[model samples]
Target: MARVDRGAADVITSDGHHLAQYAAPLRRATVDDPVALPCVGDWAALTRLPEGRYELDAILPRRTAFVRGGVGRDSRGGLSGDSRGQVLAANVDVVFVAEPALHGSDFADLGRVERLLALAWESGARPVVLITKSDLVGEHLAGLLDDVAAAAPGVDLHAVCSVTGEGVEVVRNHLGGSRTAVILGASGAGKSTLVNALAGEEVMETQQVRASDGRGRHTTVHRELIPLSGGGLVIDTPGIRRVGLYEMSRGVDLVFADIEELAEECRFSDCAHESEPGCAVLEALESGELPERRLESWRKLQREAAWMARRTDARLQSEETRKWKVIHKSMRGRGRP
Candidate 1:
């Protein structure tokens, strides 16, 4: 589907035709689970009914689905419980991690960049770092780029100024025909501005960030796919505040490869990198090789990802057990002893 609203979607077909399609009864019933619902980048199977209606029957298997853990009610339907992943975008080839250049030239949030990179890596898509509003921090741009580069490993990083049209084409080159990209960032990150600039038109709404706090209003509240003039597609998503990890250990390791490499050289196989003797990670910290803050960020993400994995496993196990119980009860009832 091109875009998914509350229950409806705008589906684009092979012939470049678009239509508003609503979910069929069965699919609607499954909408409560975000995984089962049709997302903006999903390719869905639609059925045409006699009364001029289009039914989104099913979503095709996605090559890649970008998801993040979101808080939801539990079995008891209480106010708080374990979080589950909400699908962000499907079948994406690249994720552009946008961080706006701060006013008065404050340092960009590399910690958030690390977090976003981990999530992006977990999405099974290549990630590119875009420092939006590059013109704001022109003189101070080089140092900021170096800082972000250290945080992001093996990722293409760029400084893009949407209003001034700097580095915009380089960004667009990533989204050619058949390749899809999603812009991910927090509010006031100049994501909407970048999107509009890339589309070469005012396709997405733009808002000015507050000069005091350097935060932009939530202009793009929902995820929507916009087809570019050059043939590829781009999905614009709302600014994400908290980026909770969902089973991304390898991603974490990849993002922090410097620390990972150091960990492998530790004297003990299970060194916690604290006060352990012959700890390579600790050595790096003490020698100023690895910043303490980065190490802390890595550890925090690792723990959160592990916790999310455990919760996911438990939830699936409970669901499976419940299904078996219901099946056994039905079988026993039919026996009529």
Candidate 2:
């Protein structure tokens, strides 16, 4: 599926044809489950109705999906207890995390990049950090890149400027030959501009960031998959304001692999790394091998991931309970009849 909306999706056929279809979930599919719904980069089975309208029958199994904790709103426009995992994109091979070099501060937000990297790693896709708007940083660009690189270990880092067309080819190289990528970032991070650059045309819209805050509006409202003329596909998502970690596995550990490695060398198996004797993590921190900020960020993300995992567990239990209650009620009704 190229794009999925309320009750329809834009689907691309095997013969390279595009068409919009009324895509609704099958009756057996759980509508509450985000994974059951159609998303960008999904391969779907469609059926033609009597009137010749195409209806989506089912979504094929996904190789990888990008999901995040999503909170639903109440009737009063406030957050409710409907916290579920929302699939951002499905069947993605590469996840491009875009962070502008000249944002609020002089450099990109390393914390945000790390958080996105953790989620990207969880998505089963190769995470690539794109430091957008490198032209504005001038000579400090190299230092800024190094900082981001230190934060995101084992991930490819590229300093790209959509305006000047710098470092775009490096990004484009990853998207050749049927590989699908998704661009993820906050507002005004130059994600849309980068998509346009990669597409080699003005396929996506662009907006100028504010002079004072350097933040752009949510230009791209929905996630749409665009097939590049140069072979490959890209999914462009909206500017995410709050990114909550969903059920995490080894993603957090992978993001903080350096810390994990140090913790392995700690004196105690269960060492908290807090003023412990022979703590390798603390030793690295003291010796300037590890930055204090990185350690703190790792700790913060760990706590968040743990909390979200518990919340997801509770939600699943509640859903299972509700399902049984309905089943019992139906049995009682059948007995009465």
Candidate 3:
């Protein structure tokens, strides 16, 4: 076990190799205790224990953070949700949006791919598209790569097969020491298989896809940060079925940059780009320069982001009002008047 000096916890290994270090000296509340907290890809100052043990003391500053909203139950016990930002990973350089091969000669789900790309861009990390399971169905790799390139302009796309070990080196070449990357996709996308192949061992568990439907069950339950033997680190996350847009306005703008750039020529400064005369975005769509699907995706994400912001703002306002009421009650009791 290699003990890393992260400053706080002593690293100990039962198998004589360092895999994981204890997070904190004592169990503490996640909400109340803030310093000893740990997030994926965080470099911590740890304390080395006797016999090669380590514990985390403090988390160093992060270069980037990928956050998502936490879901909670509502008052009626159905699904009341508030936006609690949970950091998924930090300091990630690249985010791999892996997708499975489409079945029955149908092309892959481009819209889902675009959503993941938007989230990746919003994560403050460079996005890379990975189309997995190339070995199955004899799908041409170039066509998938081309589709991805068209869907996500200015992003790297790779066609990789974990089972055949094809196109894996290209992914490894980009990773090195201190570089972190995250793998994201739905269940049965072969993310765990890809992770195992990249690690050169069975570090993650993989499940076989159903023969009839071509869908697989979720195998990974928790998110983990694992160091690769080749040098860099990788964060493997649970299969995400849906990823909602959360305050990702800049990312949506970046995704539809062509439309945004053309909108400057609109007659009104706040043109909706819908039925507005002299709207350059609409003109481009009419001229066949811009795909209607791309514009629709942009509009959908923009509206979703705006709705998320409104919900978050409403929650904050409620909290603020409650705080003021408490303060007023305290002042009334003090009799300062």
Candidate 4:
């Protein structure tokens, strides 16, 4: 469904037709499956219930899904101990990692962009670094773009001012040909404004950011897909608060591939990137060949991904043990009868 509101959803069909579908009940076992969840950009088979209403019969396998850890909770309503990956969007082709260029956050949020880029690369889709609110940047645009480009290697990066519509067309070109794009960023990053500009209308509500910190409120309450007039789809998501790693080792490798390759030239096989003898990474940093900031971002994400992997393994082990316990309990009950 394009817009999931309350218990109902606004479904869009193959030919751009719209239909209202009542929420479908999910099975207990399938409810916890991230792939089975009805997210924006999910392809599903529809069914006509006996009550003359439509329901999502099946959620087909997604080609590409963007998942993040820490969305699930423990029994006490706190964050879960294990890495519970919540799939944000499905069947996505491109991810727009938007960050605000205006305000003091332009260069300040490069680490955030790096973290999001790791997540985006792990989603099996392309990532585009979008610096929104470009007009507010003035002459610093070129410098800021250079910094962002260095942070995002082998990815498309652009500075787009949605209000003046500068560079918006270049952003839309990435969404052409019925491809699905997902807008991912923190609150007040001008995600909704860019969506409206791409749609050529005010398809989403936008609010001004706080003057003190330039942070925006949660204008988008949920993730919903909006079809663009120029073709393609975009799933607008609410501002993400926590972006803990989601078993994204491959993504981490890609984001830090430059460092990874550089490490191979070190003297020792197990050479850490620290102040070790003949460490290529450290040498590069000393010579200004590599930025210290980029290396720091790489190290942080690597550690986070490794920790999340251990947590994921523990969670799966617990789930397996619980499954066997339930199976044994059922067998005992049947034998007693």
Candidate 5:
């Protein structure tokens, strides 16, 4: 499927030659799990309804899926009570984490990049960090790149200027060979502009950011998969203001692999790394080997991932309990009859 809205979807034929817009509706079973519904990049089986409409019968097992917790927004601009995982894209091969090279006094939001990278790693896709608007930073570009690179170790990092076409080719190279990549970033990070650059045409609309605070208007409201002229596919999503983790302990560990490695040398197996004697992580922090900011970011993500895991477990247990209750109720009603 190239796009999904409500219960309908725009599906691309298996041969990749035809696109049927809003032609596929969800099968009853497919509606049980919201995250399992058709999403951009998902390969689905379609059934023809008697009413002459195509229904999304089933989705093929996804090689990778980009999911986040808390689908709705709360009053404080955080995730709402809805704890179900929301799948952004399915079967994605590359996750491009974009951030503006110049954001007020900061070159890029390293924390956001780290968070997105964790999600990308958890999605079973290769995560690449793209520092957009490199042209604006001038001589500071190298330093900015280094800072962001520090945040994303063992991940491909590129400082790209979509307007100037600088560093865009290298980023596009990963999308070759019929691979699918998804652009994830805050609004005004030049995701759409980057997509246009990679596509060699204005496939997506672009909007300028506000001058006062560098925030951008939401130009891409829906997630749509666009085929690149050079080959491969890209899913452009709306600017995400807040992205909550969804049962991502492995992802968090991968993101903080350096800390994980350091912790192995701790004297105790479960050292908290907080003033614990012989704690290599704390030692690295004190010795300037690990930045304090990075350590704090890792800790925050770990806590959040743990909390989300607990919530997911509770939700699943509750659902199972409800299922049994319904079954027992049905049996009781049958006996009475």
Candidate 6:
């Protein structure tokens, strides 16, 4: 439920304890009125009707929001190029990155995992790396889990097979009530399978992946916020194979904490770690302390994030100009000139 007006509520809890499922008309206010309304997960005062219906009065403020940058449309139905990050959800606590498992022969793809880790870290939520199909990999699983841990420092990592229920209990224990988590990964990454195991029901659909290609078919098509039977909420988004780093500079540093720490000891305070004198990051590589591949990945993500930030900022500035122009035009349309 949430605050609506002087003493009214814009939303209330449904009998299902889900989002308020009803949309009521303004009793005193008429049509064509602007909406300054409440959103999901808001607390509202309610007036119960004899028919067992309820009315929302107001929307309480939100604690936090999960957002991503997106483009806006213009009058011609084309993208204005001006973009802004749209809020995906609010009050999320954990970001579950369900990734594909690597059997003995091939190493699990670390690049993609790093990107997801950066995204999760940037979301201001705890990131838990859930590696699926550990049972299939047999004894070689330990090395793969270690690789993931090395890729993402200071994050909880788990390997589970939905079929065998391996490590499922550990994953469930992390989702304490009142805390929310968002699941992100590629198609066929076993996100739905994990969610089903956590929810203790088959709420989401799942598909079998192609053995030859190592890719799974898409089962979930929409971004839905599902309530776990235990207590907290889990937002299951569609299979996201590609996650573009829009503006996650701070997140990059956090994800590559070791490299960042090494750079701090460089001779120059602003050392770029690229052919620079007295570069500690490079020294670590030569001394076998840091792998060259890890440093390269760090540089790639940093560059991409920086570039994306520039593009997004440019789009935002253009959008702000357009909004002001429209407002000025509306003002002139109302004046006698």
Off by over 4 Å in 6: 1-14, 17-62, 71-82, 327-337
Predicted candidate 1 versus true structure: per-residue lDDT over 237-311, tens digit per residue: 999987777767578888998998999999999998889999999999999999988999988888888888888
lDDT of 3 by residue, 10-42 (tens): 222344434455454433534432322466666
Give me the candidate number with maximum lDDT: 2
Could you give candidate 2's per-residue lDDT for residues 142-165 as a string of tens digits? 999989989999999999998999
Candidate 5, TM-score vs. the true structure? 0.93
**Residue 187 local lDDT, model 3:** 91
Residues 83-201, candidate 6: write the lDDT tens digits. Answer: 34544444568888888785446557788888888877776778899888777777788888988898898889999898778888888778786777778788988888888988889
Worst 10 residues of 5 by lDDT: 17-26
Off by over 4 Å in 2: 15-28, 74-77, 80-82, 103-106, 334-337
TM-score of every candidate relative to the true structure: 0.93, 0.93, 0.83, 0.91, 0.93, 0.78
- For candidate 4, what is the TM-score? 0.91
lDDT of all predictions: 0.85, 0.88, 0.75, 0.83, 0.87, 0.72
User: How well does candidate 4 score on lDDT at residue 35?
Assistant: 43
- Cα RMSD for candidates in order: 2.4, 2.3, 4.5, 2.6, 2.5, 6.0
RMSD of 3: 4.5
Cα shift from native, residue 104, model 6 (Å): 6.3
Q: Where does the lowest 10-residue lDDT sum fall in candidate 4?
A: 20-29
Each candidate: how many clashes?
1, 0, 25, 0, 0, 19
Report lDDT (Cα) of residue 284, candidate 2: 97
